[model samples]
Target: MPAQIYALDISGRRTRPADPLSGHRQESWRVNLLNNNDVLLTQLVGVVGGEFTFNVNAAIRGSGSIEYSGTPLDWNQHRVQPIYRTEAGGAAVEWPLGVFLVATPSSEYKDGDRTVSLEMYDKTKILEDDLIPASYQVAKGSNVITAVRAVLALSGQTRTAFEESTQTLATAMVWPAGTSRLRIINDLLESVNYFSIWVDGDGVFRTSPYLSPADRGMSWEFEDNEKSIYSPEFTHDFDTFDVPNRVIVTGQSDGDTAAPVAVAEDNGTGPFSIATRGRVISRYEEGQEASSQATLQAIAERLLQTGQQVGSTFSIQHAPIPIDLNSVVAFRRGVEAIDVATTLQTISYSMDTGALCSTTLREFIQ
Candidate 1:
């Protein structure tokens, strides 16, 4: 069994009396629908799910759809939890795939049957819809985190798990009326070098400081061993044509004087570095509003770190693990002499009963 689907029964026998859980497969998948306030609405039954996809580049980073053979119910901005049991039997534990919100819902009738499909996205969707009503600015001497928390209040998204950054704003960041809250939040995160942003399994807006894959080693492993959850087929790919070796961010002055330019370059002996590559693969951008040189430098470094060259990504399948883009796992496909660490860049899961997962991982070449 892949997903090994199950339902939530807080009381009574979950499985058979004697056979509490499967010896080999542990437990099944469980899902729950919740209201906007996160109160239990109902446990979804007889529902089949489409692919639940989460990618780092997407604005609405996480999305999925679920279909059931019944008329649609009132469910816009409603939440859902895709759950699974970690162990077998009464001693088993439950973990959620993610806490997602219903984005759009549709209903159709055919052959005397009514089918309803709900399209869901993560909590970040709310920020996308919210707009700043007046001129907004995080003053030069203010704390960006406080400003971020206040902006999140615009959409009533207070459940946040953020690393308290001590980055004092060196320059006032300004946005006009009608600016997107998501963009503002993203910019604020970038200024503090805290770029990893996502709504976690419990629908909390989670943030963490940016770090190289080389600095992190933990969690899970994928090997060529026959018993491993990873499928036999392994894929290795390189996107080297567009690899960037330098990032230059120019500041556009809000008033009279423009801020100085800031640039980040791969200066070391790595294959993608400017010295080794010979030819400079440069990416340039102008800030929306002028910022101090320190701020511009931070932005330049952020852009460079996120867009690295020699892009080697691998495609693999693994048992549904409580992992996200922030996760870094070790990998070894010994047959082709391929042994390298991997950082997940794209993840997609088939959320149907007994379904599995697929991910594209960035080859961490330190």
Candidate 2:
């Protein structure tokens, strides 16, 4: 036969503000399931204007009954008013529940909209044999805990792989600036058929097009009528120029002079520095895949001398710059990852001004 369990009752109350002149006031009361000792498991606070919500989680155990009630203090006393109730089964079990309450003030209550309050109750059953007082249980003879750890490890690996794949795709397409131009170039590279042509900054025209049957499958053409301009600009400006007062040097020989080294004079802050303002510019005709390829190759070679590749993926990011006394230094940093294989293309740039800008070029491959 299944074991029988008793219901637990819960209850609480809060006083309402009294009228200033009449001196009449009332208290609000609420009730819920209580355990064998009549200790209330749920309590309700004073409600205002008819709406309330709270974050709560609850769990109940055993075949126990639960009940809730509410009463107003100005009127006759009520023993128990049921606001919420639930029944438990004979077997040991956990029941999770949340409660919300809404109430309209009586006509005699003065000067307010409807009243509302939210209450939370958690119920759990304790078993006689399994109950341990003031202590947590340690698992002795089961692999459940270890199995959970293994599952977490597998999930972590999957999450890591997903993040890596996302980052790889993100770095594959370079978008230094001009996202709008990148979109246009990506579309042209993907959709255009015929010959691919590009106009360079110096006005050079180049093309790679599918030739008619008379000329065979494909041909490349270059126009020498106009010179293309390459004007990639890199500029840096310094905001401060105070020179350091002290210079520290190591490895002074015993016979060397012991006088301190002279402080170096400060150079006037300018817009360009050999170190800060170095940039490369290349011009290619509308459809010159070879020019694009060569340009990317050159840039990659230059970047290789400065930064290491971030993995199998092609992305170059700068290392953290060390601070120098009284001045900030800017360096040229770039990466070239996408290989141009087709003629139909678009060029993009990152710079805010100038005709030839930085952009992410998307080339669609069949």
Candidate 3:
């Protein structure tokens, strides 16, 4: 593996020097890419960001710990962007991990040298720290994109600056009274069929369809024994704890309390004794336009089917490539011959040896 180039930019500025940071006096860096499905503090995290850890020799900035002594590095900054690239066949290809907010920087003495480890997070961290304005609100009958833009604009962000799907909300989102921006985004996501939100390496906010890939492009195959470099950790289970067997949707418009309602139920769960299990009900309140009985029933049925096929997650380490979440991919096990087209869920990347990526995937249903 030839040496990979790396550069550290301040305040999300793009740095393109003749000689990159890899040619400078740094050891290496590791990046952990996370998406909405990834959990943090027991909560679902979103708008894809990453934890970047890098080690640098003290000779570059003098050997001193900021926690103990004065240091030359600026700890307070808007963003720290890390750009990396590999040289192959005399040509170089670059991959810029998203700009991150420097969280912590620690220094230690190892052998005869002092090394520093800088930990950073993506810009989405701002969302956690900042609160949505109390007076902010989305108008009735506004589309999902419009609502998202309104939410983002609270923090001086624009939806036009991010990658997003053209899909709109089935009904207008209700932002009754005061609501956090995070809550508003999650609610909008729930109303859409397969959409998700994430931030990209370019610092662009993205609201795109995931877990439902319209295009199944490319595939990665692994066979047990000698055919593959590694095997994936796969598991499947059924727990009735929060599993719903029935769903009810009620359509109610303002000043019209006599709207119709719809319900969907599942009567078969094999011979596992349906009598022993109680029905779990999910209730959805209609906003904006009153939903028809057929629409409500369809929504219930879709949820039921999705719950039934929750599917397995596949985690594997393979060559690195920028794969977006919810994109369709093919996975095959040797001798099985059955090809599984699935959704790319979460991604983790490491560059100690070479450009390698570990990704988690959820099976996509037809």
| TM-score for each model | 0.84, 0.13, 0.60
Each candidate: what lDDT?
0.71, 0.21, 0.46
Off-target runs (Cα >4 Å) in candidate 2 are 1-118, 121-132, 143-366
lDDT of 3: 0.46
Candidate 1: regions farther than 4 A off: 1-27, 70-72, 86-93, 251-258, 288-299
Alpha-carbon deviation at 354 in model 2, angstroms: 54
In the range 249-353, model 3's lDDT, one tens digit per residue, is: 665443545655666666665321134365444535454132234544555665554554344456666545434444566676655454565666565554444
Best-fitting candidate, scored by TM-score: 1
Cα lDDT tens digits for candidate 1, 1-366: 012234335563354323223334554666787888777778877575556888877987898887766435666646888776645454554556678877556777889887777788888888988888998888876777887888898788899888887666767888899988999988887766676467877777877777666666555577677556677786888877778889988775546666568889999887788898898999998753333466677768767766772388888876666567756777787777877777777778775555567888877556
Q: How would you order the candidates by lDDT, starting with the best?
A: 1, 3, 2
For model 3, the superposed segments whose C-alpha errors exceed 4 Å read 1-72, 83-92, 109-116, 133-135, 159-179, 192-194, 209-211, 214-247, 250-255, 258-306, 335-338
Candidate 2 residue-wise lDDT, 35-130, digit = tens: 333334544333221211111111111111122123343211111112321222211111111121112223323264333222221111111122
Model 3, 216: alpha-carbon shift in Å?
6.2
* TM value for model 1: 0.84
Report the lDDT of model 2 for residue 291: 19
Q: What is the lDDT of residue 8 in candidate 3?
A: 28
